[model samples]
Target: MSSLPITREQILRVAELSRIALTEEEIEQYARELTHFVDMLSVLDTIDKDGVPPTVTLTFDPIAQRDDKLEPSLPRDEALAMGPVTSDGGFAVPKILGGEG
Candidate 1:
């Protein structure tokens, strides 16, 4: 509640920094909405929770996870066969860092 109200200039500046184009009406709308949101959050400051414990999660059960296992891979020759170019038993690609393709 002690925080200063949001301003149109602040909204416009934020939109400019984000590279967003906003109309005059849109800027006013966002300024009002952001001010309302902050006011609502400020209400939390008045709550009394002296004996309450912070909640981490709703459930304590261990999460089920699939076991990691190695599987057979495709043969190199067969894999290279699908490529447009092949060289030395592997797929051939153009050199990116520079020299020769």
Candidate 2:
């Protein structure tokens, strides 16, 4: 394997900074995986990308926004009255604590 740009110490430091708890085995495994990834990605340096236009995106704007215009819509009071539970101006939902209360 090529010399690894990352070290176990660096990995440990990152984990500590991120507040992540990893076991010794996990740290060793990640070190090896990261080293391999760096070595593999180094092959990209050999590519001849001269004068190649940088790719902006693989697809055009996926979400299209239409021009804003005034349109007929339901009245506020009627819409609120349709709901079984309504608050001051919106829907009233049960209190959720730890996903359930």
Candidate 3:
């Protein structure tokens, strides 16, 4: 809402939260993109609104959800057959990052 728009500091903070490291050029690019987004929101705010009700979605109702019915599943041996590796009724995977296998 502030006309000051997004800053490089804000971009850096966002990148940190997302666990991403950005170069100086990337930080400047993201700041510019965020500023443009704010400008678009500002333009949207200037449109006339009379009798329009705020709706979360254009659809009439929430998208229909599938019924939660459990069906027959694969037997343990059958399921394990498709896995790359398996242990006692569980999947055994290769070493994950930063840990020994």
Candidate 4:
């Protein structure tokens, strides 16, 4: 439509913001497509949806949650023994960065 409002400059600005390089033809295509999409969305806004309820989820099943219960875990020494290096009752991994913190 002639009234559909996306300019070449606006399209270029959007492409710059998105870090994309669009050719002249692609830019024209996107400008037309985006304008059409926005027009469609505006048309949708005119529809009456007061009777419709907002949906959180469409699924019938309730979300399952695991029961929290205290259980015996592996002993500190036994767990630490599996590690390549154990210092001060903990696992020691190789230093990743040059810093002593």
Query: Which has the greatest TM-score?
Result: 3
Estimated TM-score for each candidate: 0.44, 0.49, 0.53, 0.44
Question: For model 1, what is the error of residue 75's alpha carbon versus the real structure, in angstroms, after optimal superposition?
Answer: 18
The stretch of ten residues in a row with the least summed lDDT in candidate 3 is 1-10
Q: What's model 3's lDDT at 95?
A: 91
Candidate 2, overall lDDT?
A: 0.84
Off by over 4 Å in 4: 1-3, 50-57, 64-101
| Cα lDDT of model 2 by residue, 1-101, tens digit | 47646788988998999889999999998888888888998887789989999987676668677779988799888889889999788888887866762
Model 3, 1-101: lDDT tens digits are: 54566988899899999999998899999999989888778876778878888876687777998789998888889988988878989899889889988
TM-score comparison, 3 vs 4, better candidate: 3
Model 1, position 79, has a per-residue lDDT of 88
lDDT of 4 by residue, 1-101 (tens): 23458999999999999989999999999999989888777866777998899898787889776789888999999888889987999887777679663
Please give, for residues 8-98, the per-residue lDDT of candidate 1 as tens digits.
9999888989989999899989998988888889988789978899987676787777678887789888888889988899888888666
Model 1 lDDT on a 0 to 1 scale: 0.86
Model 1, clash count? Answer: 0
Better of 2 and 3 by lDDT: 3
